[model samples]
Target: MSLFQNLKSELIRKPNSGKHLPFVDGLRFLAIVPVIFQHANERLFKYGNLPELKGWEEQVSFLISRGTIGVFIFFAISGFILSLPFSRENSKLNYKTYLKRRWQRIEPPFIFWMTCCALILLVMQAYPIGELLWHYLATVTYTHQLFYQEYSIINPVAWSLEVEIQFYLLAPFFAFAYFQVRSLAKRRSLLIAGIFGWILLQHGMGWHLQPWKATLLGQLPHFLVGVLAADLYQKPVKWIRDFRFWDLVFSLLLLTLAYTWTEELGKTFLFELSLLGLLLSAIYGRYTSRILSLSWISIIGGMCYTLYLMHLPLLEGYYSFIARFGQWSGYIGQLSISLIIVLPIIFLCSVIAFRWIEQPFMKKKDQKSLRSNPIGKQVLSKA
Candidate 1:
């Protein structure tokens, strides 16, 4: 195939595939870009030697500080996607197969990039081999967040993945339980109760837990929001599905409230609600935002996992190189230079990683069946 055709194939979804949601991919892009902006802004402030912004610029900076919001959106997307399989009527879920697929989808790229980061640390003599070995072990096992107060020595982003893995372990049970409820109203009530309960627990009891926000308990509400969205998507109501301008209006209103809220619980709750509005608008609204649903945007969203994992390291490395080779300019000039040089590099690296490292390990139906029934299938074949 020609390059254009190949790119098209990758970007465009095959219609009626329940597994593929282009709008969700677009949502991923939205979530990840803010994260990139957050890191970029930090690097610019640290290394750019720019004069501090006094007025509007400072306000803009504060807005970008909301980059962690991307992580919340990601958790919601995870909940929605994972629960989707279980929410369908009469769906058969084999735990062994489900876990195997989850591992295959997540582990390979994570391990690959993590090992690369560790090797870089070794080469730079950043730590003793003995210490580095322990760090690597802790990181790969997703235990670094529990044991250490700081971000992972290998990759700070891995902290979120630890939370994600915890949810992965619990999601099957949650999905199964959700399906057992017969009445939709009761199900909605339970979801609402769970959301509020988690909020209360996080605010009330979380003080006793160090680094509470990073733990699964504190983040459970965000994932639960996604589960609710999944439920809506699976059995969509016409009122939600029919596109309306009010959906966007309500979403923006919630987002504004989230931004204004001083308390963590309030901010998180509002932000999650805003994300739900956006998700609903994208999925059901008659007039979906073209920017969000565009092919290129969705493709970027598809590569978000790889981009998120690698961007910080790449930023650090680029900053180090520029520091050695160049002199600092004003903020605008520095930011412009960094954007011109770094953004393309990040995009290129992300594309390569997505194509080779991440994509290869994604669960294909044939591979999944083989993995799930390896010995049984082999014996049958022999017979």
Candidate 2:
């Protein structure tokens, strides 16, 4: 291969979402996989021709649906990733530039996918343009939940992105409060409180409430946990040590639990604590960290945004197309078949978006510290 092609080929595996760093990308990988599973699992019952499940099948289906813990993981990862810049010593945020850069990096691909998905829907489903247009506008503005108190009409998964954007706008302020206290004990104590505080409030106020569940207040605990992780990640973290197999086991156990959990808005105190352990293992566990840091794995994890944004739309197309072939019965066969068919398509499309679309934004140098960078002011100099 030519040198330019070689460079691009290698770079394509490096996800630019949060520094193209293995540790964060690995976590991203962890976060995105379950989300895909959550959706796939949900779709199996819908498109899989299975009757309302009974016995263990019904119970298992409900538990498998808990793959949404990945979304909460993403929230924590965002908190951890964004905290790097603002959490650095003597840090001061350039509010306007920060917001601008965030938009520039994230908005184009988001808009592209949204527009494409909307157009495809219009053409295929033949929804009235007036209704679709209004929903499209609302989705674009991230205000769909407020109007409809539900997932985006254009992109069902965009509800999480809406929550993400809410966190993004407020992250710096949260950081300000976090970093203000000079005492480490006091600062960490504050984070712990914030974490539980939000969880308690959500559960206390009833997370089942429609519009409120869609907001940041519902997910703030997860973000706070991420902030706590950032603080630990920036140093050797005196308290954190690889417990060899135990730490690895700890991570796996929590992951299994997260996959099976069916409960609150996914920002509970135990969940937040579990995120810290889960992420810390990925960051610090000798065995766990090595596996997570594998080049290919982290590379795929980095492209999670594309996978996330495009998965549902792609699935819509896939199921429709596959319906022509035949339908599969039994949840087991359906799950396996859907994943085998759908995952490859999602990855292929994500690679294209990552290399051509997202990477260009990363090339626009900013004063942001990367997770891949050694905990400091190491700017990503675009080649």
Candidate 3:
């Protein structure tokens, strides 16, 4: 198969698997693009600090400030996708297999990039070898988020990976508990209550926990919202699916409201709700936006994890090379130039990483191939 075809097959939901949802890939695209833009915006602001573009910088920053919301959307998507298997009737839990699959999917590219970033930082910053080793260990073990809250030692985005790992470990328990509740109404009610309780804990009660902002407790509501979304996906509500135009309208409205809320609590609540609305619209609402449903968009979304991991480092590298030319006059010129130079590089690198480093681990064990080569199969199976 051609590369595009391979990506499309890998990304699109298989028709036979009821859990496969193509629109969700599109949603992933939506989540990752903002993050890329946000990082790019930060780089542009850092390097293009021209006096002429001061007013434009503030305006652009405000617009892209919500890029972090994409992370919340990602958390919710994780909750939804991970919990989906359990939502089905008579789905058996295989803890060993689950962890193995997750490890294969998430770890290889992470380690590859983490090592690359660490090595680059070590040489560039000229840190002691021992200190660099410690930093590497902390980041690879996902401990950096707990001890080093200011900045990730290697890759800045790995902090979110730490949070994601926390969720991955607990997802089975969450799924089990979610299934124990017999009634759908009660399940939804409990989810809403959990979200409210989380809000109260984080905001009203002032209970700040370890790992600070990256703590699972602080982000639990978003994941719970995703769990709720998974339930909705399995047995979609007629009203929600039927409310096409209004669903889009309300989602956009919530997103707009999100801009006004500067506080973490308000921002989290509004953005999470907005994402939920958009997700529902993408899944159930009859009128799907052509932009989101496009094959190329979904393809990019499929490569999001790789894209997210690589974009920042690539941006920093690109900026270092381009900064010598000096800043462009206007915000548009700066943004356009940056995008033109940076985006293609990011996309190309992500695709290469996805194809080689990531995709190999995603492949299912080939029993036929294994049977043909007994000794090699034994080694592969053990691996």
lDDT of 2: 0.72
Model 3, stretches more than 4 Å misplaced?
1-19, 52-57, 205-211, 250-254, 257-261, 264-267, 366-383
Residue-by-residue lDDT tens digits, candidate 2, 1-383: 99856744655443334345566777788888878877877766555566556688777776667778888888888888777665667676555656766777678888888998899879977688898999999898888887888898799999988888898888877786677777887888877887777777777887636678777867677788888988877754565753555354656656655653444545344566677888778877777777877876777787788788888877767776665555556666766777898888888888887778766765544444443332222211211
Residue pair clashes in candidate 3: none
User: Using Cα atoms with residue i matched to residue i, what is each candidate's TM-score against the true structure?
Assistant: 0.88, 0.87, 0.87
Q: Could you give the C-alpha RMSD of every candidate to the true structure, in order shown?
A: 5.0, 4.0, 5.1
Error of 2 at 34 (Å): 1.3
Clash-forming residue pairs, model 1: 243-285, 243-286
| Every candidate's lDDT | 0.74, 0.72, 0.72
Best by TM-score: 1
Candidate topping lDDT: 1
Error of 3 at 201 (Å): 0.7
Look at candidate 2 and tell me the lDDT of residue 227.
87
Give the per-residue Cα lDDT of candidate 3 at 86: 73
